[model samples]
Structure formats: C-alpha cells, structure tokens
Target: MEAVVFDGNKLKLSYEKNYPKPEILDDDDVIVEVHYAGICGTDLHIIHGEFPAIKTKPIALGHESSGVIHAVGKNSVYKVGQKVAIDPNKACNLCDFCHKGNYQYCLTAGINSTIGIWKDGGWAQYVRVPQQQIFALPDEITTEQAGLCEPYSCVSHGFNRASPLKVGERILVLGAGIIGNLWITTLHHHGHREVTVSEMNLTRLDIVKRLETGYRLVTPDVLAKENTTYDVIIDCTGVGKVMEISFNYLREGGKYVLFGCCPPAHTTSLNPFQIYNKELTIIGVKINPFSFPSAISWLKAMGSRYVDYHKLGVKTYALSEYADAMEDLKKGSVAKAVFKVVKD
Candidate 1:
C-alpha cells in the first residue's frame, strides 16, 4: 500500500515497507480503506509549526476523511464494505466530559490524523478507526460529499451552540471562506434571509457572488461606514482586528460567535463600554460534540437545495500531488483542498 507520509513538515509518498494492512485493533476498532481526505487550515498551521507541538517526524496526516469498512472488529456493529464518514476525534468514553456527552471536551479526546500532523491519518489506502467514531453516509451522498461531513459537523456544532436564531434577524458573518460560507448556508437553511457576510478579498467575494443567493458580500471599508446593525455577528476571520471591527456592527444585546480559530497566543481588544452598556451575548465554539448525526440528517434533508455538496469546495489533486495541492491552497486558488486516495 502507498501512503502520503509527512516527515519533518514535508510531505512525500512512500511505499509501506513491511507496514501491515490496517486491521481491527480492538473490539470497538474497524479498519477502513480510505477513499478521500480533505485538507484544512489546521493542516497548514501544523506544517508551518503554528499549532501545538505535534508528531515531529514521519507520520500519516489526514483527519477529515471518508471511506469504506475494510474490516470490522469482533464486537463492532459496522459491516464490511459499508460506506462511512470518519470522525477524527477519538475520546475516552470513561472520562468525565465524555460521560456527560461532551466528548469534544474530554481530556483524552484526540485523533490519529493520518497523512496529517499527528497520528497516521487517512492520506493512505487504509486507516484504523474506532467504530464509534464512524457515521454511515446516506445513499445520496457521494464520497466527496461524505468527506465534507467532517467540516459540516463543525458548522453544525456552531449552529447548535448559537440556537434560537430569531426570524428576520440580520446576521453578519465576517470572512467569506469555507467557515463563513457554511454559516451563510446554515443560516439560510434555518430561515434567516437577512444574513450578510463581510470579506475583504475581491476574489473570495466573487466566489460568493457566483453562488447567486441573498448573501450580501461587503468589504471592510463598506462595513465601517454602513450604519446597519446586526442581531448576530459571527467572527469567522480569525483575525483580532477583524473581530474588533465587527463588534461595532452588533446591535445592542446582539449575539457574537467566535467561529474561527485564532492563533494560540493571539489576543483581540473589545470596548468595555459596549459590553457594559449594550450587554452583548458573546459565545465561542471550539469543536463538535454529537454534531455528526445532526449534520448528516440536515444534509440528507437539504440534499442539493441548500448545498451543492459536490461543489462546496475545490478538489485539485491526485494522491501524489500533495505539494501542488498545498501550494494552491496557500496561493488562495482553492477553498477546501482535497486529496484523492481511492477512485470510483
């Protein structure tokens, strides 16, 4: 078998020299033949040494992956050859957070992101995963769409965290990237028509404009001068200055969701007067917990109406073009860059 191995921040395809085929490791473990893997900003951060200290040498690197069950452990309920979406987060169910249904907060929560920065990920032909972390894809969803379930789960988690969105409320999503776009789609699905997004990049704005929806794309300069206020302001830019500027657009008592991941040491300033006088409900979403089920069900229901799951992001690499893939992403030529591991 061939795998895209990450060695010292560099990616290279290597033959499995005496590497055993993935097999069920425990009663709850299942071996999967990886089909597709999605590369995200986290992958870039890891490569640039911006993330927390991770696996330092050669390792597998994918987490957002989808594939078929190659083999199931003795006690696992999943059947062989079943199509599934992999939830990369592995948690100790015995932990306090997991016991309370907050697996994302579990102290032992982690994943073996293969072909990724940590554990061997799904950038290979086969991966070992826990049965509990897999979700069966609906028949209508393709492998590419199934792969999207991971990021969708993250978006769904954000929506769950920001519940009770008032109808007719105005929403301001700061950032026109994947996270920003997902928020727009999610808001539209839930009947919020007044959602507006702010993006400075003209290219990204053009991409959003091509979607042909009610999403209003604006530049920071426009937002700064506009007198309009929003009931919900979501900071998806992950920039401190962006967040600081977005705060002024929030209506009194409005809700603000910090949806993007900022740098570990990053900090942003907020006006204390606004907090005391206007009484804003500021919320932050970290990771998904029990969000996969809802995300799958929502995708099934929406089908192609709200999301062109097939075209949500750009796919531009064969299994071996890993370097070019990362380059395209860095150049902002692709949105959600994905690597194809298995073919149809």
Candidate 2:
C-alpha cells in the first residue's frame, strides 16, 4: 500500500510506495478503502512540530476522510461496499467523561484511541477503523463532501461554543482559510449575513469574494486602519499575534471563539482590564464531541441543497500530488485540499 508517513523520530513527512497494509486487530474492526482524504492545517502544524498531543509517529497523516468499507468484522452490523465518513477520534464508553455524555473529553482518547493523530489513519489506500467510528454516508452527499466531515464537525462544535449567537450579530472571522470559510458558510446557513472576513492573503480574499456570500472582505491593513468593532469575533488564524490583537475587534459583551490550533508552546499577553470592562467571553474548542451527526446534517442540507461546498474552494488532487497539495495550502491558494486516493 502507498501512504504518506510521518517519520517517527523526525519532523518529516514522506510519500512511500510500499507501506504496510493495515490488519484488523479486533473482532469488530473494519477496513475502509479510502477515497478522499483532506489535508488539514493541523497536518502542517504536526509536520512543523508545532501541534501537541501527538502520541505516535510514522503514522498516516489524514484524519479527515471518506471512503467505503473494504472489509468488515464478523460481529459488525455494517457491510462491505457501504460509503462512509471517518471520525478519527474514538472515545471509550466506559470513561468518566463518557458517563457524563461528554465523550470528547474521554480520558482514554488522549493517546492511541484517536486514529490519524496517534495511530495509523487515512493517508493510505486502506485504513483500519473501529466499527464505532465509522459514519455511514447518505446518497444525497458526495464523497468529496464527506471528506470534510471532521473539520465541519469541529467548526460546528466551535460555533456552538460561542452561544447566544444571533442572526444579525456583527461577526468577524479573523482568517480566510478553510476553517474560516466554513465558519462563514455555517453562519450564513444559519441566517447570519454581512460577516467581516479579514485576511492578509489576496488570493484567499479573492476566493471568498467570488463565492458572493454577501460577506465584507478586507485586508489586515484595511482592518487596522478602520478599527471597526464587531459584536462577535472568531479567531481562526491561531497565530499568537493575531490572537492577541483580535481582542480589540470585539465589542462589549461579545464572544471570542478560538477555533484554530495554535502552537502548544505559544503564549501571548492580553489586557485583563479590557476583558473585565468589555465583559467578553473567550471560548476554546478542543475537538468535535457529539457534533459528527450535526456535520452530516449540514453536509446534506448545506452541501446538497443550500451551498455548493466545492465553490468554497475545496479541491481534490491525485494521491501522487501530495507536494502540490502542501504547496497550495501553504500559499493560501486553496480553501481546502484533498487527496483523491480512489477513483470514486
């Protein structure tokens, strides 16, 4: 099997031709023949040794993917040939957090429980997944849409963390990457319009402009010059400086949703008095817990009926084009990049 492997001892990613095929270890395990695998910003962070909580190396690098069942366990209810989306994060049902219905915080999920990050994942032609983490895809959605299940779920979780969100709030998304674009799309789906999206990259800004979502797009320099305040500010940049400076963008009683993955060792200084006076609420989301179902629903409604996700700049490349995918992502030329592993 061919795969993109993370060098165990070094901060390097390599495309290998003869990677070992994954075998089912448990009676209920299922092997999915990957079709579409998304290259996420977190993958770049992991490659640069910035992302924390990585438990293992030499692991396959895709956590967001969609495919079909190549093989199923004897005890599994799911059958082969079924299309599905991968939820790489798995939680132990017997844990304390699981008991409280907060499985995202499951203690056992901290290490080898999650697939793409800690164990082998979908960066290969085949990936072994626990039966519980497999989500069946509906016929109404395409495989490309399903490949974004993980990040869509994460954005859904983050948006909800900033509770009391209104339909006409002055929302500011600080970044125009896939996550930021997804945030805008999700907000627009929920009846929010006139969002102000700030970015330094002109190409990214142009992509958003072409989408014609009625958003107000501007460069960082223009934003700094205007000094306009927003009712809710969402930081999708994850840069230390951006996180620190965004405090000035939020209005009184506004919510600050931290949706991006910043460096684990990165820290910044903020004005405590401003937080106190403005009565701002800062919320941080870890991973999608119970939001996988929501992602499916959104994919069906938003992807199928309301919005065309591909128009948001999600593009698919051949598995052999891993270098081009990374380069495109680094240049902010694509909203989301996916590796097409299978012909589907």
Candidate 3:
C-alpha cells in the first residue's frame, strides 16, 4: 500500500517495501481502507522535528482519519465495508484512566489512538485499528464530514472542560483559524450573547467577521480598551503573548481557557498580582473524551444546515501533494488542510 512515511530526516510519499498488509494483530482489531485523512497542525510539528520525544523514525502520520472497514478479526462486532470514523487514541483499558473512560490519558498511549502520529497512520490506503476505537459513521455524514470528527472533538472537549457558558456571557477566541473559528461557533450555538475573536491576519479576520454572529473584532489596541474584559476567554492561537493577553480579557470571576498547544518547553511571564486580585481560573485541556461523539451529534443536528466546511474551515489537497499541504499550514493559509486519499 502507498503510505506517507516519516523517517525523521524526510517525509515522502513512498510505497512501503514489503508493506505489512492488514492482518489480525489482535482478535479485537479491524482492518480499514483509509478514504480520507486530515493533515493537522500537530502533524506539521512532527514533520519539523518539534516532537522528538514522542516519535522516533519511519511512521505513518495522520490522526484525523475516516474510512470503511475492509475486514474484521474474530469476536468483532463490525462488518466488512462498514463506514467508520476511527478514534486514533488507543488506551490501555486496564489502566485507571482508561477504566474511567479517560483513555486519551492512558499509560500505554499509542497513536494519539491508532493511525497517524505514534503509529503507521491513515495517510495510507490501509490501516489496522482496534475495534474499540471505531465509531460507525451516521448515514447522513459523508466521508468528508467524518474527516472533521476528530478536530471538532478536540474543540468540543475544550468547551466541555470549560463548561456552563452563561447565556449572556461574552467570549474572546484568539486565532481565527479552524479551532478558533469552531470555538466561536460553539459558543454561539450554546447561546452565548456577545462573542469576540482576535486574529492578527486581516484575511482570516475578514472571513471570520463575515460570519457575523454579532461577534466583535479586537485588534491589540482594541483589546487594550481600559477596563474592558470578557466573561470567558479562549486562547486558540497558542502564542505565549496571546495567552498573556487572553488573561487580561477575563473579568474578575471569568474563566480563561487555553485550547492551543504552546511549545512544551516554552514559558510566559505574567503579573501574579492580576491573577490573584481577579481570581482568574486558568484551565487547560488535552485531547477529546466524549468530545468526538458530541461534535458529530452537534454537526448532524445542523444537517444540510451547511457551514461551508471546505471553504473557511477546509482546503483540499491530493495525497501526493503532501508538501503543498504542509506549506499551506506553515504559511497559516488554511483553516484546515486535508489530503484527500482515494479521491473520487
């Protein structure tokens, strides 16, 4: 099978020599033919050698993947040719976290669950997944829509972590990219009255502003408005400076949520007095748990209530155009860049 392999020094579209065809590695595993996969920001970081600790050499790199079950092993509940969204995070069910359904935090953490980073992922024509992580795609959801399940799940998990958005509360989402834009939509979907977004790129801001959810625009100067604050602030930009500024927008009892991944070794300087005086709550969320299912449900609820998934939120690329996709992401050119494998 053709697979996008990462071997530290280079990432290339190559045929796996003596590639291991899908076989029942475990009785509970299912073999899948990957139809579509999303190239995520984390994939970019991995390719550039930012995450040297988690990954070591030649591996398939994609987490947001959807496809059809080509085969299933013994004792499996899935049937051949069943459309499914594979959860990449495969946790050790024996672990305490897994026992509590927090599998993403499992001790034996594998490809953030199956195919993508950490293992031979979905960027290929085929992948083997544990049956437990597979969710049947609803009939109304297309292969393209299933591609969004993972990322949206991450955003939903962040919202879940910062639950109970007051109806009239105001929110500021930093970064108007995929995650940032999704945060705004989710807040509005839940009835948050006034939501604002701060983005440095005018092009991105223009797209977001046009969404016109009665959302306010905040440049650096605008955000510095004297005594101006928000009931809740979500930092999706992941920039340290933006994280710092996000705190300033939070009211005394307001909550601050950091959804973006800042450099693991990075640090930010902040005023301790402000945190103490305002009683701010700085919350951080990792990956999804019960978040993907919620995202799919929410999306399906908006059935045919299109939000232009491929326009503002997605940019399509062919499998061989991985380099172009990576470049698009590095240049901050697209909200989401997806490599369409097995194109119709």
Candidate 4:
C-alpha cells in the first residue's frame, strides 16, 4: 500500500509506494479501505516537525478520512462494504475522565494515542481502526462528503463547547481555512445569519462570499476598524497574535471559544482588568469526542444546499500528487485539500 509517511527522526515526509498495510490486531477492530482523506493543518504541522510525532516511529499522516470497510472484525457490528468515516481520537475507556463521560480528556491523549498523529492513520490504502471510532454513513452522504465528517465533527465540538449560544447571536470566526469555514457554515446552518469571518487570503474571502449566510468578510488589516463586537467569538487561526487580539472582539458578556491549536511556547499579554470589567468567558475545545454522529447527519441535511464543497474551495488530489495539493493549500489557492486515495 502506498502511503504518505512522516519520518519524525528525519523531519521529512515522503511518498512510499510499498508502505506496510495495516492489519487488525484487536477483535473489535476493522480495516477500512480509504477512499478520500483530507489534509488537515495538523498534517502540515507533522510535515514541518512542529507537532510532537516522536510519540512513535514514522507513521502514515492523515486522519480526516472516509472509506469502505474492507475487512471486518468478529465483535464489530459493521460488515465489509459499509461506508464510514473515522473519528481518529481513540479514548481509553478505563481513564477517570472516561468514567466521568469526558472522553476528550482521556489519559491517552498525552501519550499520542490519536490516529495519524502518533499511530498509522488513513493516508494509506487501508487503516485498522477500532469499531468505536467508525461511523457508518447514511445513504444521503457520498463517501467524498464523509471524508469531511471528521473535520466537521471537530468544528461541531467547538461550537457545542460554547454552551447557551442562541441561534441569532452575533458570531465571529477568525481564519478562513478548513476549520474557520466549517465554523462559519455550522453557525449559518443554525440560523446565525449575521456572522463575520476574518481572513487574509483573498481567494478564501471570495469563496466565503459565496456562502448564503452573512457577508461580513474582512481582512485582518481592516478587522479592528470594523468596530464590531460579537456575542461569541471563535478563534480558528491558531496564530498567537490573532488569538491574543480576538479577546477584544467579545461583547461584555460574550464567550470566546479558543478552538485553534496555537504553538505550545507562544505567549500573549493579558489584560486582567478588561476581563474583569467585561465578565467574558473563555473556553477551550479539543478533539471530536462524540460529535461524528451529529456531524454526519448535519452533512447529510446540508449537503450541496448549505455545505457546498466547491464553494468552500475544497479540491481532491491523488495521493501521489501531495506536493501539488500542499502547494495550493500553502498558496491560499484552496480552503481545504484532500487526497483522492482511490479513484472515483
């Protein structure tokens, strides 16, 4: 099986034609024949050696993917030929957090138990995944759209983290990348029409304009001048300075959802007085714990009507064309990039 592997020791990513294919070790595991896999921002981090991939040896690098089950496990309910999407975040059911029903804080998180990040993931022809991480797609969602389910679920988790958020509340999403676009569309679907999104990429801004929702797209340079304050502000840029400045956009009692992955060592100055005066709430969101089922349903209902992949600037490339895909993404030519592991 061909795979895009990241050699952490060498700090390089390569296309290996004869990479070892995965096999089911656990009776509850199933081998998915990958169809399409999205290249997430974390994949870029792994490529650049920014993400801590030394958790294990070199591994296939991709997590947001959808596929058909090629091999089924004895204990799994799903059979071969079933279409599904992977959640990637495998929680240790024995942890205290798991016992408390908070799977996101599972003890395995620190140990890089996450698929693609530490273990072999969906970038290859097939990946062995626990049945718990797989969600069978409905008849309405194409396998291509299922490839998007993982990222959409992550965004859903972030949105769900901002509890008590009303439908008509003012919302702002920073960054027009994959995560940012997902946040905007999720808000739009929930009747949050008058939403604002900040992005520097003109191409992405143009794509954001096609959205049937609000048209408050603006570049970073002119963001502060908009004089806009939002009831809920979501930071998807993951840039330290962007996250730092987003604090100013929240209304007096607004909530700030820190959904982006900022660099570990990045620091920002805090204004304790301003926070005290505003009574603003700041919360952080992690991986998609229990969001895949809802996300797949949302995608089914919103397909083409509200969540148009082409309008979102998503394009698929052959796994062998990873360089071209990565180039387009880095150049802001596409909002989301996915590898077409198998032909349509």
lDDT of every predicted structure (CA atoms): 0.75, 0.84, 0.75, 0.84
lDDT of 3 by residue, 1-344 (tens): 66777775564334354555667889888988888888776776666666532345577677888889998989799999888887787666687887888876775764344457667778887888889889888888887778777877888888888987778887778888877877777776677758778877766776675555777876666677657788888888767777766677788888889888776665677778988999988888777776668978866765433345644557877777777877777777777787677658
lDDT of 2 by residue, 206-289 (tens): 878756688989888887888589998888998878888777888899888888888888787889899999998889888888
Candidate 4 regions exceeding 4 Å error are 109-111
How many steric overlaps are in each model, in order?
Answer: 13, 0, 8, 0
Ranking by TM-score: 4, 2, 1, 3
List, residue by residue over 215-310, the lDDT tens digit for candidate 1.
778888998888999999988877767787788888888999998877666777999889878998888886677788988887787677656633
**Candidate 1 lDDT trough over 10 residues, lowest sum:** 108-117
Candidate 2 residue 260 C-alpha distance from true site, Å = 0.6
- Where is model 3 more than 4 Å wrong at Cα? 9-21, 52-56, 110-114, 209-212, 225-227, 304-307
TM-score of each: 0.91, 0.95, 0.90, 0.96
Instruction: Give me the overall lDDT of model 2.
Output: 0.84
lDDT (Cα) of model 1: 0.75
RMSD of 2: 1.7
Could you tell me the lDDT of residue 61 within candidate 1? 70
Deviation of model 2 at 122, angstroms = 0.8
**Between 1 and 2, whose TM-score is larger?**
2
